[model samples]
Target: MASSDHYFYVLQCADNTLYAGYTTDPIRRLAQHNNGTGAKYTRLLKRHPMRMIHLEHFSEKSPAMQAEYAFKQLSKPQKLRYLTEHSSEWLPK
Candidate 1:
């Protein structure tokens, strides 16, 4: 069996706002967000069918949450730059 690790992910809402969060299962969590069963931030925004734009893996919840919080603190331009440069497609170091 695979060991569980937390993941920090960035989602692009319909209005193009970025939302950061941590989850053990990105796919299921994305589904929840789309179905309006996820975070109140996403749900209340009425930004359904969100698209995942980035993801980072962490061995523990603390680091995962820390990543989410850090991403959330970034300004829009900084967030966009971070996504463009540190995209999940590049893979983690």
Candidate 2:
């Protein structure tokens, strides 16, 4: 598949925090997160069963990484606004 089909996503951690990452397989990624061997942030949170709250697609890995970095730098309020605006399609059931 094309890189444009891949996405970087954020999950709302159990502690009400956010975890950012890039993956073409969000479902498998979520499993990895719950399994304690995903991103360091997810491992630290250890709050299994995180909810997929945001996702942004990129035409390439570089841009996806860039977006991930930018997301990480946003303030809590900004992040919340992002989630709010994107939730319609991004948020998991």
Candidate 3:
């Protein structure tokens, strides 16, 4: 795979909750969440995921997973701040 394949992403679900995850394609992963074939938590929520709100591209799965862990450790407010600050840098055009 290419160096741009890994991605650490955050999604804003229909219920206003955010979910952090790592994937090779954020868009496709979001689609999977919406289609109920993604994470077990998202699948159990039964709420359609709205979109990928933030993401950090990585060249390796380990790095992406590390980013995901760091993101998940942040409080909701901190996560929101991170998304707000990095929104322009990560979100797809």
lDDT of each: 0.83, 0.79, 0.81
lDDT of 2 by residue, 38-91 (tens): 987788744766878777777688888888888889998887777778767554
Question: How do the residues 1-93 of candidate 1 rate in per-residue lDDT, one tens digit apiece?
Answer: 544689999988877677889999999999999888898888865576688888888888888999989888999888877887989552221
- Poorest 10 consecutive residues by lDDT, candidate 1: 84-93
lDDT of 3 by residue, 3-63 (tens): 5689989887778788999898777888899888898878965467467778788888899
C-alpha TM-scores of all predictions: 0.84, 0.80, 0.83
- Name the lDDT of candidate 3: 0.81
**Angstrom error at residue 88, model 2:** 1.2
Q: After superposition, how far is residue 32 of candidate 1 from its true place, in Å?
A: 0.5
The candidate that wins on lDDT is 1
The residue ranges of model 2 lying beyond 4 angstroms of the native Cα positions read 1-4, 89-93
lDDT rank order: 1, 3, 2
